[model samples]
Target: SMFVTNSSFCTESKECLEYLLVCKTDEYEVRHYSPTRWVSTDAEAYFMGVGAAMAFRRLFQYINGANEGGFQMEMTAPVLVKIPEETRMWEPAVYSLGFPLPAAYQEKPPAPTSNKLYFSEMPEMDVYVRSYGGWMLSVTSRLHAHLLTEELGRVGASYNHSYHYGVGYDSPLKLLNRHNEVWYVSEGEGSFTSQRLV
Candidate 1:
C-alpha cells in the first residue's frame, strides 16, 4: 500500500499517511485522501501550542501501550492538529490532535484506556495544501494558513474556512529540514481523480 512508502519528509516513521496529488501550483497543491482511522484527543486553550501539547500527551500514551490490549505501536508521520479558524482573545479554541492508525491496525485498532482518547474516522476528501519548513508553531501555522487562503481566494477556489489542519512530519528532536503543512478542506471542486505523488 502507498501508506508504507514514506515521502522524503516523513523520515521519522516507517509508515505515513498517503494522498494522491491532484494539482499543484506555485502557492498551493490539491490532494485527495482516502478514508482513514486514527487515535485522537482534544484540548482547549487560548493558544494552539497549549492545546496541542495537552492533546499530544494523551495520544502519545495511547500509542505507548496505554490501550486496552497494551498494544504499543510505532509513531506515524505527519501528525495532525485540527485548528478552528474562529476564536476570540478571551475564548479558548479546541485543538484536536490525531495519529494515523498503522495499516495493520486500521481495521481493528486497540481501544484507548483513557476516557479522553477516542477513535477518529476521517472520510475520503480533498484538501488544499500548503507546505512549509521549521517547527509547526501556532504562529507559523496560522501565517501559512493565511497565505494559502489568500492564494485560494485569488484562484477563486472554494474551501471550508471554518477549520484547517496543522500537519507536522518531523519530531522536535530533529533540528533541520523540518516539514510542515496547512490544509483547507475543499468544497465541491474535489470530485476529480488523480494519481500524482507528493
Candidate 2:
C-alpha cells in the first residue's frame, strides 16, 4: 500500500498520492514518484486558473459517478495540473488536470463519459518541487514556478524545461493552511545529485 491517507499537506483527502523524498534544499524539495494512473481532462484558456477550473469540474464529475459504470469514487490528494512551458500572451494554453485514481480503481477504473476526459498513466520519475501557501491561482502558480526555476538554475539542477506541474492538495472550501506545489520534472536518470536535507 504505497498510497497514504495522511500527509502534512494533504489534510482533507481520503487518499493521498505517494512519493519518495529524494532530497531537499533550502528553497525546494526533490521527490520521486512511482508510476500512477489518473483520470484527466484538458481545457484551453489564456490562464491556468480558468483552464484548471473547467478541467476540475469535468474530473470531479467523473469521480462523482459520471463514468460508464456510474460508479462513485473517493477524492484523492495532490491533484496535478500539467502546464506547458512556453505560451504567448495572445494564445491560449491547454492545461491538463488530473486526479490520481484510488488504489482500487488504478488498474481498471471506470471509463470517462466525456470525450475530453481520459486516463493518463504517468511514468516513474523525479521532480523538483516548491511549496507555496494560499490559493493556487494563475498568478501564484506562475510566480512559484518562476521562483522554483530560478532556484533550480542557481543550483544547476538538470530538469525538463518544456513543461511543469502545478500540484494542489486541498479543496477550494479549505481556506487555511492550503498547500500547493510547483513541479519541474527531472531530465533523466542520474540527473540529480542527491543529498539529504539537513
| Error of model 1, residue 28, in angstroms | 0.8
List TM-score per model, in order. 0.93, 0.94
Quote the lDDT for 161 in model 2.
88
Q: List runs of model 1 lying over 4 Å from the truth.
A: 189-198
lDDT by residue (tens digit), candidate 1, 16-103? 9999989999899999888777788889899999999899899888889998889989898779999889989999988888888888
- lDDT of each prediction vs. the true structure? 0.86, 0.87
Residue 88 of model 2: what lDDT?
92
> Per-residue lDDT tens digits of candidate 2, residues 1-198?
658979888879889988999999889999998877778888999998899999999999999999999998989988999899898999999988888899999889888888888887777789999999999988888899999999999989899888889999999999899999999989867332222111
Regions of candidate 2 where Cα sits further than 4 Å from its true position: 190-198
Best by lDDT: 2
